[model samples]
Target chain A: MSETPTPDGSPSTWSEDRLHRWLAEQSWPATLAGSRGHDAAVLETFAGRPVLCTDQCIEGVHFELGAGGRAAGRKAVLRTLSDLAATAAVPFAVTLGVMAPRSIEGVPLEAWLRAAITGAHDAATEHGAELVAGDLAMVEGPIALAVTALGHTSSGTVPVGRDRAQPGQLVLLSGPVGGSLPSDRHLEPLPRIEAGVAIAAAGATAMMDVSDGLAWDLYRLARASGVTVRLETERIQPHPDAEDAAASSGRTPLDHGLHDGEDHELIATIAAEDWAAFRREGAASGWHVIGTVEAMDRSAGHLQLRSPEGHSAWLPGAGRGWDYGGGE
Target chain B: MSETPTPDGSPSTWSEDRLHRWLAEQSWPATLAGSRGHDAAVLETFAGRPVLCTDQCIEGVHFELGAGGRAAGRKAVLRTLSDLAATAAVPFAVTLGVMAPRSIEGVPLEAWLRAAITGAHDAATEHGAELVAGDLAMVEGPIALAVTALGHTSSGTVPVGRDRAQPGQLVLLSGPVGGSLPSDRHLEPLPRIEAGVAIAAAGATAMMDVSDGLAWDLYRLARASGVTVRLETERIQPHPDAEDAAASSGRTPLDHGLHDGEDHELIATIAAEDWAAFRREGAASGWHVIGTVEAMDRSAGHLQLRSPEGHSAWLPGAGRGWDYGGGE
Candidate 1:
C-alpha cells in the first residue's frame, strides 16, 4: 500500500511538532495566557466558578467519513458546548484530543486535519469560546476526537444542574425533536445557549440537553430528581423531517420524535409560576410545554406518556437510543 | 471473527451506558457536583486560575499490549500530570477518553478495561486528583486513551511557563535522562509536582517537562524563548539504565541521555543570580546545571553541546525522538 501524504503533500508522517506549529499559528481567545509550547494552557477566570465537561465523537460511532471532516470536528466541539449550555454556563476555552487516521478517503492526512481544526475553530468562535490547548495522535483506525470545554457562569448565578427538578413544575422543550437523523440535524444542531441562560435566569429548577432520545433523557432527569415526568404525546412537536423519517423507518412521526437521538434541544423544569416570565423573555425559539413533573411512584414508572385521550403508559423503550457499542 | 469478551468475562461490547454505570459506582472528588448521568461533570474551583492540558497514549504508538493495560493507562495519566507539574499547577480533575480494541491479546476486553480504569484511578488518587468524567468507544484497532487534566494555581502564585527564559540564564535539570524504555521508567516516572512548585516559587523563569529527548526539547525551549542553549556534555548525567540501553543499542550512554524520549524530568531556566537561592531552597535531589542560555545566532544552530576537551558542536539528530506516525 502507498504511504499517506501529509497536508504539505510530503511523504513525511504527521508529527506532534507539526501539529503544535499549526496550533500556534491560530488565534486563541484573549483570556488565554502563557506560550503555546508549554505543557498546559492557562486561562484567567472572570467568574470564579469553573464549569467543565468532556465529550468524544468517534468515526463509525458518532459520525462517518461521508459526513466530511469539518462536520466531524464541528460535532465534536458542539457536543461539549451543548453540555455547557445544559448548565447555563458561558464557555471560555477548550482542549482537544484528536486521534487521526493514516488517511481519510484518499485525502492527505494533513488536509483532513486542517479541515477538522478549521471546523472546530469556527464552531468555538461562534459560541464565544477558543481552542486553547490540544493533543494529537496517529491511530491505525478511524479518527476519534475528544473535547473538554471549560466554562463559567455569571458572578451570582449558580449552574442549573440535572438533579434539582421539583414536583409541580412545568416541563419545557426548547425546540422540536425526533427525525433529526434523517435530516442530518444531528450533525449541526444549534446548542441552546441563549434559551438555556434565559430559562435559568427565569428560575429553571433543573435542565439537561437532549442528546439520546427524548424519552431516555427524560427518564434520566426523573431518576436524578426523584420525581416522575409525564409528557403529553400530542403536544410534542416532531421536526419537519419527521414525516420523511417515519416514512422510511416504518414508524410514526411522534415515534421518531420520542426515540430519535441527537436532537440537542434543551429540556428544562421550571416552577409553574415562572413559565409566563420565561416565555416573556423572548428566547429565540418559543417554548413548548410538553410535560409536567409529579411525585415519583416506583410502581407507576419514572416516566410516562399521556395520550390526548387522557390515558397514560410508561414510555416505550424505557432507556433505548443510539448505542455506541451496538445493541440497545 | 468472534466477539470480544469484556473484563467481566462477558461477551459484550463496551457500551457508553455500561461505562457510565461503571463510573457512577466510583467515588469522585468532593468538589464534583451534578448527577453522575449528566452530560459532563461540573467542578467547583477553589483557585480562580484554571490550568488545562491534553495528552494521548495509544497502543503501538505510546505503548504495546505486552506492556500491560494498567501500565498504558498509568502512562497516559502520568504524561498529563507531568505537564501539570511543569506548570506547578495542582490537578483537581481529569476526563478520560478511551477507545478499546476488538481484542487485547488473549485476555477478555472487559478485563482489560477494568485494569486500565483501575490503573488510571490509582494514579489520579495518588496525585490528589479524581476521575470525574470519561468516554469509552469500541474500535477495530488498538486501544487509545486520551486524558485532559484540569488544574489550578494558588491565589497569588502564577503558573510556571515557557518563553520567559532570558539570554543570561542557567539551565537546570531536576534529574537524569535517557534509557527509560528497557527500565520501564517511562511507565511510572514520579511527576515532580512539589519540586516544580518550589522551583517556580524560587524564581525559575522558564520551565518544561522533558517528554521528548533532552536535545529535542531543549531546542524547543530555545526556539520559544528566542535564545540559543548550550549544554555542557561533561555535566550531563544519564539515568542508571542508560549504560545498558547504550550497550544494547550500540550507542554511548550520553547519546541515550540526549536522544531517548519519555524522560519526564523537569527542565528549567533561572537567572544566574537566582541559582544560589534555588540551591538554598533545598529542591528534591538538588538541581544539575546542564547549560546556559545565550543570544540566538540562527546560523550557529539553536542548540549545541560543549565537550570536556573545550570543543563545541551542534547536537546530533536535530529533532529526532519518538515519531508516532512511523519511522523517526
Candidate 2:
C-alpha cells in the first residue's frame, strides 16, 4: 500500500501499481485478451445451459489461518469446480474475490496472495476454465477467498440434479472417501470433473459432490429425491488416509469414509440397466457401487447405513470424521 | 443454525431447512428454473458477448459493521452492476457469496443476512437481471460479501473499454458527482446502465464509470488510451451535496466534484462529429461535455486540469475529495 518498500521486500508494501503489474503478467487465456483493459471481461456465449456456482473459504472456518497460501487457494477453486462436477458441467470461466489480512505467519502478504492466486489460477486452467475476472482488497481480518465458476453441460446434455434419483437406482462413488480434513487432504482436493461428466454421460440419474461428508450429503440427496440411500458399508472403500486416521481416533476407517468432509468425489445414482452399460464401457472402472436408492418408507431416515452382518443404523444429520453416534 | 426456535423467534437460530425454504420462495427468474434445486444455477446462452465482473464489500473496510443491512447489500450489488455499466453490458444474472458474522448491532444475523440478500436480489432483478446462485457461510470476523455479475453486451455491440480514447475526442460526464460518501449517496448508487448503452450505441470511442473519483479514473482512462484528458474545470457539474459540504469544509465544491470516490457516473469520450449526432438524438441530455482528449505529449500529466484563465496543475494519484496541493 506504500511506495517505500521494506528491506526484506515485505508484501505489505505491495502498491496498487505493483499489484496491477503482477496481474498483467499472468498467463491469461488467449480468448480473454479482447476483454483485457476493461472494467469487466467480455466472453462469447456459453455452450449448452450456463451453470453458475459460488464457494468461499475463510481462515479458521474452512481452513486454519496461515495454513499455506497455495493450499488455501487450491481448496477454494477446486471446491467451486466440484459443484459443477455435481451437475456434470464443463468448466468455462471463473471469477475470484479475495479479502486478505496484512500479515500471515510472517510470510510476506504479497507472496501469500500471489501463491494463493497462482494456485487458484493453475487449478482453474488445468481443469479447462479460465480466470476471467478478479477483485482484491486488504482488510483487517482473516483471509477469505471466494470463487465463482461459470460452466455448462455438454450440448444436448441436461445437468444432473440430486433430486432425480429413482427408488430402484444404484448409487456409486467415484473413489474412496474420508479422513480428508485430519489428513490435510482437504487442502488440495482432486475434483472429479471428468469422472462426473463420464458418469452423467453414462446415464446417471442423480449426482452430487461429497464435500460435506458422505452421510450428510447422501441425506441431502435422499431428501431431495424423496428416497432413501441404503449405503452398503462393506462395499464402500475407505481411503488409506482414513485407515491411518482410524488408528488414534478409536473409530473404524469406514466411519471416516462415511463422515469425512471435502472428499471432492462424485456420488451418482443410476438405474441398474444404466449401470450395466456404464460398467461395460469401463466408465465405472475405479468407481465403486457403494449404495442403493430406496423408498423413504423402507428406512428409518433418509440415509441408512447397513453393515455386512445385517446391522443397520440411521446416521446423524451432521457428521465429522470421528464417530457422531450412528455406528454398527 | 438450530432447528429449535427461540421465544422471540430469532433468526440467528434459523436452521438450514429454513434457509432452503426461504430460498425456494424467492421470485427466481423463469429462465433460471432449469438451474434450480441443485448445487448450482444454470441458464441458456447469454445474449451477446458475455460480461463477467466481481466486486466485494467488507465490514469495517467498505462500511461500518453496523451500517444498515439493506443499504450495505444494495451498495455491493449496485457497485458490481456499475462495472457492467462501464462496459455497456445488459445484466443477466448474479451469484452471491456471503461470509456473515454472527451478531450485527443486535439485529438477528438472519434478519440482517436476509435484508442484505433481499437488497442485493431486488437490485439485480430491478435491473433486468436475476440472482441465480448463492453460497452462504457463518464466520467469526467482519461480515464480508462478494457478488459476481454475469452480463452481456447488446447483440452486435462489442463491450466498451477504457483504452479507446483518441485525439480530438470530446469528454463527457453522465451527471453530477462528488460528496457521495459524506452524503451517504454511495450507499444507493444509480448505475448508468442505460446511458452507457446509449453512449456506446452512439459510436463513442471509449467509456468508464467514474467510481474512484473523476480525477483518478480519468487518469486511468488516459493512461489506458495512451492519451491526455484536458479538463475544462468550469464545465463540470458539482452535486448539491458537494456544494452543501463545501460550505463547511472550506474547499470549493468543484474539488469534491473532481476527487470524490464512488460517484458511479458514466464518463464518455466521443469525436466532435459523433457528439453532434449524440446531441441531435437527445442522447446527450443531462450529460456534460467536460473536456477534450489530446495526445499524451500535449499535457504535463495524463489528466490536465485547466481553469478558465488557463491556469492548471497535475493532480495527485490517490484522491480523497480533499486538497492534495494541486489547487491553482
Candidate 3:
C-alpha cells in the first residue's frame, strides 16, 4: 500500500458517525461509499460480458493487523484481483464490505479507516478498476473485509478455467513462490492479469491461482481436470524470499516453493504446441514451465513429484501449504 | 431464508477439511461457493448496464445468532437485495464474504455454515438473482458477512438517483417503516425493485433507501438534492409491527415510523405532475405519498415534520430510531 499522507482531521472525537461524515468529506469514491443518499452504487453504463468474484480477509484469521489498515485493505483487494487474474478476467471495478473494530493498534478508528479505504481505492485505481461500495459496519470484533471484483473477459478469448486441462498439456507458473508469510511478501501480491490475458489469448486450456501452496493447488487443478500433474522437481526454483528464509527454517528453498502458500502466482495449462507461440509475446517472460499433465490413476491422488531419484503420488492435506479451514 | 433440511452427513469427524469436502459434495452454487475447480465465478455472458452494491451484516452487531444460521443468512441477503431495490436496479447476482465463528448457538460449525449457505442461496434464487462467490473465512470472532448484489438498469428508465430531486416534487415511500428491530421485522425486508422501477418509469427525480430511519435518510436525500423534504405527519402511517411495538414503548407509532430503522423501504421523489402517470401502472401500488419537496433553508436541516399543530425542522440525529454506529 502507498504511504500517502495521514487522513486530514482525524475527527475531533472517534465515533462511527463522525468517521462516516469524515469519509464523506474526503475525495474517494463518493458515488458509492461515504455518501448517504446513494442507496446502491450504480455504474451508469457497462455493456460488456462481465465476470464477478468475491473474497474475504479477516484479521486474526488471514493476517494480523500489525501492519495497520492500509496493508489490510491492500491485501484484501489484491487477493480479490488475484482471483480475477486466475479467471483471466479484465479488471473493471472493486467493492468492499468492511466490518471494523473500534480502534486499530490503539489508534482511533477514523485514521485507520481512511488509510484503509485509500489503500483499496489506490490499488483499484492502479489496476484500472474503480473502488465502489457503500457498506461499512462498525463492529467490536476483528476487522474483516469482503472484496468483490467485477470484470469482463477480453474479446475473442474465452475465460481460462480450472477444469479444462487435458492429458499431454503443459503446466505453467507465472512466477516464483514461497516464504510469503515469513517474509511478509504475501502483502504485496502482483496481480498476474496480463499473464493470464496472454495465456488465454494463446489458447490456454485451464488456469488457477497459487494462493494455497503450489503442491495443494496443483493437486486441485489435476483433480478438477481429471488428469495427473507430474512436477519436474529440478525445474522448480525457490523465490528469493524462500531462499532467504530457508537458511534458518531447516528446510530447502524448493520445499518452500512447493509448499508455501499465498504467492498469488498464476498456474496455466496449454498444449505443447502452443508453448512456442505463448512465449513469442515477451509479456509471458516470467512464466516457468513447471510440469506436465498426465492420465490420472482413478484410485490414487492426481498429483505427483517426479524427482531424479523417484516419483510418487501425493495425497491431499499431507503437505498442505495453508488450510484456512484449519483455524488459526 | 427457506428452512431446507439440515446439511448432509454433518461430517462425522468435524474439521475444516471435512467441512470443505462435504461442502463440495453438496448441490449449491457449485460454480462458485462449493467447488474447488473454479478459481472465480464467471457469468459467461452479461450484456447490460450494471449497478453494483455491497452491504455488511455482522453478528452481535447487526443481528443476534439466537435465530440460528438460516435467519442470519436470510437477513443478510435481504438487506443487500433491498439496497438494489432502492437503486431501481434489477437483481442479477449475489456474492458473499463470510467470517464465521465456530459453533453457532451450540451447533457444530459445519451445520451452521451449511444452513447459512443454503439460506443465502435460497434467498438469492427467490429474488431472480444467482448467488455465486468463493470466499469464506473461519474466525473466532462474530459471524460477519459481506454481501455484494449486482444487477442492471432496465432499458428506457433512467436509474433513480439521489441528487435529482427538484423543488415542488412529491416524496413517496414504497411502504411503511419503523419498529423493525423490536418486532424482528427487519429480518424479512421485501425488495422494492418493481416499485422502484415503476417509480423511475414515472420519472422519479431522486431515490434513497430507509436503512437509516426515514428522518435521517430523507434529510440525506434533501441534502444531496439541495432541497427540503417537508413530511406530512398525518399522511405517514406506522407499519403494523411498529404499532404493535408502540403499545408497549412510550413513543407514538408515527414517531416510530419516522425514526425507526431497518425497514428497507424505498424513498423516491417525482414532479407533482407525474403522480397521475406514476400510479397509472398497477405495479406502483402500495407507494404512499408522504411528503413534498421544497427549497432548503440552507441554515437548517433539510427535513421537517409538519402536523396539525405546528411544523418544525428535524435535526439529523435527534431522536434517532437507530444508530448502527452506536454500539450495543
Model 1 Cα lDDT, one tens digit per residue, B1-328: 1566655566545555566666666665456655565666666656647889999888887888777778888888988999988987888888788888655556666656767877887788899888777777778877888899988765566556787788989999988889998788888978788878777777787899988788878887887888889888878899888988988898889989988888889999988777887677666364689999999977657787778666444543433545454432
What is candidate 1's CAPRI-style docking category based on DockQ?
medium
List model 2 lDDT by residue over A57-80, tens digit each: 888867875577788888899899
Give me the displacement of residue A49 in model 3, in angstroms: 2.3
The per-model lDDT (C-alpha) reads 0.78, 0.79, 0.77
Tens-place lDDT per residue, model 1, A1-328, is 1566655675534555666677666666456656665888877755646777888788887888778879989999998899988888888888888887755555566656767877887888899998878888878787888888888775566557778888899898988888887788788978788887778788887889998888888877887788989888898999878888988888889988888888889999998878887667666375679999999976657787888667454543433555565433
Query: Residue A158 CA error for candidate 1 (Å)?
Result: 4.0
Ranking by lDDT: 2, 1, 3
What are the root-mean-square deviations of the candidates from the true structure over C-alphas? 3.1, 3.7, 4.6
Residue-wise C-alpha lDDT for candidate 3, range A1-328, written one tens digit per residue:
1222335534322355555566557665644421343767777454435778898887876677778789888888998898888888878888887777655544556667777877887888888888877577777677777899988777666666788888999999988888888898888788888888788788788899998899988987887788989898888878999998898899999899999888899998998878877677665767879999988866546888888988877776566545666521
True contacts kept of each: 0.60, 0.53, 0.64
Model 1: how far residue A234 lies from native, Å: 1.0
Badly placed stretches (over 4 Å) of model 3 are A1-14, A30-37, A281-283, A298-300, B1-19, B28-37, B298-300
What's the TM-score of chain B for every model shown?
A: 0.91, 0.90, 0.90
